[model samples]
Target: MGPGEVAAILFGGFALLIILRVPVAFALALAVTPVFFIEPRLTPLLLMREMFKSYNAFVLLAVPFFLLAANLMNGAGITDRLIRLSQALVGHLPGGLGHVNVVVSMLFAGISGSSTADAAGIGSLLIPQMKKEGYDTSFSVAITACSSVMGVVIPPSILMVVWGGLMSVSIGGLFLAGVIPGLLIAGSQMLTVYIYAKRRNYPVSVRSNLRELISAVTGASLALVTPLIIIGGIVGGFFTPTEASVVAVLYSLVLGVLLYRTVPIRRLPSILYDSARFAAISLFCIGTASAFGWCLAYFKIPAALVSQIEMLGLGLIGTGIMVALAFLIIGMFIDAIPAIIILGTVLMPVTEHVGMNPIHFAIIGVVSLSFGLITPPYGLCLLIAASIGKIRLVDTLKDVLVLLVPMLLVLLAIILLPSVILFLPRLFMPQFVG
Candidate 1:
């Protein structure tokens, strides 16, 4: 079959399976079956081989370890401490609890590197409080889900690890690139909260006293050190990303078990189990998605598509916008990791053709995919938040879209101005970024 024929079968089968509600990992694996049977050169065994090869990478080890760290933080009551700090820092703003939710997610994003962990940990605590404070239920869930997207956009991100490992971009550069955009997204969300609170007359928290701020900061000091350890260690050349993940896990254990004594020793087993379970799900998607990606590459589909797009003679900014739009659409349907493996590879040539920087392209993809966490169809974060609020997913759609406006603007900025992502990377990791 021609490359076009293979592309049709692969994407069509995957779309049908997704519409049928088959799990994404299974759908990806299943979608390639027809190509295997139809194309004489391919075999079913190749699927297993590609999946195994995808897992054999040393860098990918960071994924599970980072997940463990997030779970440890939640189990150890580190989340609670961060919440206290967020309250002290931002609670006096209009829509106090809403701002607190965004602030805590930003802080937790620094440590956890997992949006689902942020949503589950912060949403469980704050959603109820927001409701009790007479904040609209849908709005509370929407804000929680939206803010949680920062987890993946900030440093120590699982998506960045996958993108770097797969695309051969610098993990440190990607980490640094994420900082400004993540903070921008957080700032925009806070502004949205301010507007919402003003319109609805949501309660504002009393401005914290100096003593209260100090106490909150002191309480969360250890937890705050986590991002520093993970990001600092990587940027300072003290360790690799994978090593940083292990360090994060060990530090979290020390804080939870030895320092705070909040997490009972007996709880260790369950935390490990949960972390392993989530890691497996994420990693499995990577395996299948890699296999699917392999099929596209084996057919030279990306090259063909690139040639077609190149014919249009699109400029750097135009190509960047196109890349961002593609990621946003794909992210709405699939998880980010697989999307990176499948789409990132395809677009790499397009970006490179226009002389776009790898770090700049990566930040665009990561920030765009972060939106998927809140959007529907595959909105895992939104689903988790809605479930926690005991509300239908549709109920939160209005608030979710409304809050996404500022985030979309930040995404546009990243696309239009490469400096938005490149500045920090060039400053901190000049060798890798250029």
Candidate 2:
């Protein structure tokens, strides 16, 4: 079959399965099944081989370890400490708890690298408090869902790990490049909170005094060092990305068990089980998605796409916007990991053809995909937040869209000004950016 036919069968099948409400991982695998029979040289065994090859990477190990670290942090009461610190620092702002939700997600993002964990842990705690404080349930759920996406944009991101491993981008450079964009997203969310607070007359806490700020800082200082240790270790050449994830897991164990003593020793098993369960889900998606991606490559679909896009004569900024828009749409339908495998691969050639830096392209993809976490149909983070808030998903739509405007602007800024994403990576890791 021709590339067009293969593309049709692959994508059409996947879309049909998705519409049937099949799980994405299974749908991805199932989508490629007919292709094996139609293509003369392909077989069912190729699927297993490709899936195994995808899993047989050292860097992919980071996905589970980072997830475990996030779970452990939650189990250890570390999130509570960060919440307290956020309350002290931003609670005096208009929509005080809203600000706290954004701040804590930023801080937790540095450590957890899993937005779902941030939405679950932070949402479970703050959504109730925001409601109790007389904030609108939809607004509380929306802010929590929107801000939690920073978990994948900031350092130690699991998506970056997967992207780096699959696409051969520098994990450290991606991590460094992410810092500014992540902060920009958080700042925009805070500004949104301010506007919401003013219009709604949301409560603001008394401004924290010097001693209170210091105490809050001191209380969460150890947790705050997590990003530094993970990012520094990788960029400083002390560890590979895989090793850094292991280190994060060990550090979280230390804090939970020995340092903070918040996590009981007996609770370890359940934490391990939960982490494994979540990891299995994500890793399974990678396996099936990788197989599906292999079919795309086998059909030379990406090369065809690159040639077609080149015909348009789009420049760097134009191509960047196109890339973001594609990921944004696909991400709304699929999990980010699979979206990265499927869409990121297709677009890599397009970006490279335009001379866009890989790290810049990566940040655009990551940031854009992060939106899926909060958008409809497949907005995992929003669903989690809505579940916690006990509100209808549709109720949060207006507020979520309002919060997303600022984030979309930040994404556009990175696309228009490479410096927004490139400066930190260039300053700190010049070798990788080049």
Candidate 3:
């Protein structure tokens, strides 16, 4: 069969599996079946070989280590200390604990780099507290879900590592690219919360005196140092991004076990087991999605896509906006990792054709996909937060929409002013820029 015909069956079959509620890994594997049977020189065994090769890269090792590190930190007393610190810093704002939730997620995002992990770790702690403080359940879930998206946009982000590894962009540069945009999103979310708090007369948290603020900062200092260790090590050439993940794990272990003594020895086994399970699921999707991407490359689908995009006569900014919209739509349906694996390679050529920087292209894609963590049909972060609060996803949509407006605006700004994404990368790592 021809490439177009095979592409149809592969994607159409995959869509059917999605409708059937099959896991993304298995669905991707199953989607390749028709290609093997139709192509004259291929076999099902090639699919297995592709899957195996995907996980062989050393850089990919960072995924599991980062996951383990986040799990360890969450099990320790880090979340409590960070929460107290956020309360001391911003809890006096109009939104009170609502503002606390945003600041804490921003801090935790620097550590975990996984939105689901942020939601699972921080949401589990604060959702109930927000409820007890008379905040609406839907609003609580909305803010937690909205703010958790920063986990993927900030430095130490697992999503950036995966995109960098796959696309051959500098992981350190991608880390630099994400910093300003992530902070902008966090700041906007806090402002949104403040407006809502004023309108609803949400209670303000008691302002922390100097002693209390110092104590909270002192307690959280060890936890706050994690992002510095990872980012500084990578940017300083002290370690590669892969090696930085190991450093993160070691630092978390020392902080949790030796310093705080909160993560007991008994909890180690369960934590390792759970981290392994989550990592397995994530890595498996990466493998399957890589195989799926291999099929696209083998058939030259991306070139075909480039031709189509070129015919649209879009300039760089227009092309960027189009790509951002496409990723946002895709993210709403699938997890970000698999989306990055399957689509990142396919779309790189499109961006390159228009004189866009690879790092800028990557940041645009990463920021757009970050919203998928909260958008419906998939919305993993939103589901996690809602489940923690015992509320429905639909109930949070109104508030979520209110929050997404500024996020979308920030995305537009990134597209229109590429310097917003490229400035820090060029300043700190000029060699990485195109």
Candidate 4:
């Protein structure tokens, strides 16, 4: 059979499984099976081999470690401390807890590297408080969902690690590339909160005294250093991103056990087990997605995509806009990890053909999909927030649409002005562009 016929069997089967509500990992594996049977030269064993190959990379090891580190920090009482610190910094701002939500997510984004973690950890902490203070549940859930996306855009991002591992790009360069856009997104969210707070007359906390602010920061100092250690270790040549994950785990452990005394030794086993369970699920999706991506490559889907794109005569800017839109749409359906594994490889050639920087394209892809974490149908962050708020998903989406306006604007800025994404990478990783 021709490759097109095979591609149809693979993707069509994948879609059928998704419609049937099979899990994504199983859906991907099941989708690729019929193609193997039909091709005669390929075997089911090849699927297993490809899945194994996907996780064989050393950098891919960072996914679980980062996840464990984030989970540990959540259990270690770091969330409340970060909340205290955020309140101290932004509590005086209009929509006190609203601003606190965005700021805490930004700070936690540095530590967690997972948006769902951000929404769950920070949202569970603040959403109730915001509601008690008269903030609407939908608005509380909306801000939590929107701001948690920074967890992926910020450095030490698991999605960026997955992207770097799959595409063989520089993880450190990707880390640097994410910093500015993450900050910009955080700033935009804060501005949105300001506008909402003023119009809604949301309550504001009394300005924190300097001494209390110092106390909050001092209490949260160890937790605050988690991101610095991860990013510093990677960027300073002290370790690879994988080793940096180790540093994050160790730092969170010591900070939790020795300093905070929140993580008792007795709880260690359960924490590790839960972390392993979540990590297994994520890695499983990644493995299957990699195999699915391999099938696409085998059928030359990327080349066909590039050729079709080239014929449109969309120059670099137009092609990038297309990349951003495509990922945004796909992200609404798929989790970012698997999406990165499957789509990053498929789209790399298309972007490169248009003279776009790989790092720029990487940021564009990450930022665009970050929104998907909140959009409906598969908005993981939104689902987490809505669940915490005990509100329906559709109601929370009302506010999500408002948040998306600012986020989309920032995304457009990154797309039109590549420098926004590249500035940090070029500044820090001179060798990347060189």
Per-candidate TM-score against the hidden true structure: 0.99, 0.99, 0.98, 0.98
Q: lDDT of each structure?
A: 0.94, 0.95, 0.92, 0.89
Q: Candidate 3 clashing pairs?
A: none
lDDT of 3 at 208: 96
Cα deviation of 70 in candidate 2 (Å)? 0.3
- The residue-by-residue lDDT of candidate 2 on 228-345, one tens digit each, is 9999999999999999999999999999999999989899999999999999999999999999999999999999999999899999999999999999999999999999999999
* Candidate 4 error regions (>4 Å): none
Clashing pairs in 4: none
lDDT string for model 1 (271-374, tens) is 99999999999999999999999999999999899899999999999999999999999999999999999999989988998999999999999999999888
lDDT of 1 at 264: 92
> On a 0 to 100 scale, what is the lDDT of residue 42 in model 3?
88
Give the range where candidate 1 is weakest over 10 consecutive residues by summed lDDT.
Answer: 38-47
lDDT of 3 by residue, 326-379 (tens): 899989988888899888888899999999999988999999999998999999
- Listed per candidate, the RMSD to the true structure in angstroms reads 0.9, 0.8, 0.9, 1.1
Q: Candidate 3 clash total?
A: 0
Instruction: Give the CA lDDT, 0 to 100, for residue 240 in model 2.
Output: 98
